[model samples]
Target: MAAELRLLLLLVCWTALASSRCEFPAIFNFGDSNSDTGGLSASFGEAVPPNGESFFHGPAGRFCDGRLVIDFIAQHSGLPYLNAYLDSVGSNFSHGANFATAGSTILRQNTTLFQSGFSPFSLDVQSWQFNQFKTRGGVAYGKGGVYRELLPKQQVFSKALYTFDIGQNDLTSGLFRNLSIDEVKAYIPDALAQFSDVVKGIYDQGGRSFWIHNTGPFGCLAYVLERLPVLASQIDQAGCATPFNELAQFFNEKLNQTVVRLRKHFPHAVFTYVDVYSVKYELISQAKKNGFGNPLRACCGHGGKYNYNMNLGCGGKKKVAGRQVLVGSSCADPWRYVNWDGVHYTQAGNKFVFDHIVDGKFSDPPRPLRLACHKHI
Candidate 1:
């Protein structure tokens, strides 16, 4: 009897220790181009240059020069490079899978007939990632076969964190395609409603934790600052594009409100709002401090009237009438430039954003559903 009691006590102690140190088993990510890792490249077979060239020395399909904010977060958390959930090329899921795609928006109406560059992931497509996991033996890698068997039986969904960074592309395509800033702002509430539906679907599927990001400052993008038509008739030469910024602020405020309501609806879910606007603004304001001289200068582009050619994306080979032209230009050093290809960032810039998220610099105002998953983490 004495020996049996000692064994029982030891077992109970071990269980407590293990639970205290339990780490998040997986990170399931969903967002737009800002968080995509070669998904669009795999889907399109086109190169976007100097893209992923800084760190990888070759195009790895990211929209930026090197790593993105997603990669940095994974790294800081001791996770490996996030695999594209669509990548049939690999079977590693030890870290997590990225479901984000370039040109994707949280809102469906954000899609327009006149402009079709936007390839935002629909909610249906986002759910497809779960189906992919089943094909991968119903388990994330590095967790062993025992966990695989347990995954289906246990509440494995509770041990994972879902990181979402998106919604910028919606406004981008809207404004550039000729919609006025005020026009786009008016559609934001409806767009957010659809976004909430997608989140609710995840909730029904047992997703209790969410890290969501709002849109960045669109008026400050190198592409907008340089190529945007000068509305000198409205705003003067200060170059801030006041009308455009006003719309961005309005969208961000509504997004915060949505997050708050989501928290209340699902008391068990933890929703964290990533303040991308403030993070990006901080970097742009301190560009000189970060060794980036001009935050609005695109690192990859030709020296045309607006420092860009519509025919050439960052990594594409410029051509005119079936004849190749070397019109695309690369920066001397991408590290010194924040904007990678007029719309994205350098690897360094992404790192800064990641640090802020992990540090919890802007998780305030308490969105109702956002606090659920945090208790376990």
Candidate 2:
């Protein structure tokens, strides 16, 4: 009877492991505004209303009107929405934490192009924060010495997904500073070096599953189209700036090459290079078929061909023609527009992109969303 009881206990343990829906116990994300849950708001107290009006109904510190792709990813992966690392009160770090910040660059140094100011917490800084979190077991320990076992086992860190969506700011900042595309391309090696160091640092900390997204098509963004010089002939059939799109393609090429090298360096690591550029460009190229009404215009902001006014920006009140007026206002339907407030995507746009990329075809190893948890297991 005792032997039978021991056999039953073994079966129960096997069943629990087999029935587990998600492969990884947690997901630790690193990026810029593209996936910043609340790091920017916690740091600077910005990202107020109209910013998260769609689903959240209030500013959740995400750059979108509603949810980010990362939020959708968390939901799809059977994990809770990742909380910002800086959020101290009532945050459940068991699912994982987001270390992304708005306006974050890959390199620690401030870019001279476009007067892009220094980010207090860049990717390097975020990686450092991750190291600190790993050392402390979780953010709760750092807060008050309350040793909560967020990452209980050292093996849990190896099983967690380490995702990234950065480096756009590095390229955009150079472009904004009036640096030529050639000059911007020259910075790729240095940016990739920094990115490599971050990945290596995480690897050293025992992170093995990586999902790194390449930068999207920046040329198609309303902000870039408004600021950069574009000839009428240079515009594509989809109304995107072709020259800028080419630049983005070039950057992706280089990034893919770097990913190949990283794969060689970390042979045992599951490094999925997410093709964000292709997925986003397809949405713009086929907007009419994809249920989008305005692919090139922004849902908010004022005074430009693309409805993106640099002076007004997004969610800000500005004096236009000597009168104080709201410069940015929500459109009647944000779902119909691809670009939101010039730079970021509308919630609908983000969902569309997420749906396409989550299938694993966009990933290097082709690990589907449902299998992401089991890929390394």
Give me the candidate number with maximum lDDT: 2
The residue-by-residue lDDT of candidate 1 on 5-118, one tens digit each, is 755564455444443443556677888878888677777663556667888778777888899988876775567778776665653655567777777776664453336877
Give the runs in model 1 whose Cα sits over 4 Å from its true position: 1-22, 46-48, 109-115, 131-155, 233-238, 319-325, 365-377
Error of 1 at 316 (Å): 3.1
Worst 10 residues of 2 by lDDT: 109-118
- Give per-model TM-scores: 0.81, 0.87
In model 2, pairs of residues that clash are 23-373, 113-177, 114-177
Candidate 2: Cα lDDT at 228: 86
Off by over 4 Å in 2: 1-22, 111-118, 138-154, 319-325, 373-377
For residues 263-293, write the lDDT of model 2, one tens digit per residue.
8898888777889898999999899999998
TM-score of 1: 0.81
RMSD of 1: 9.2
* CA lDDT of each prediction against the hidden true structure: 0.69, 0.81
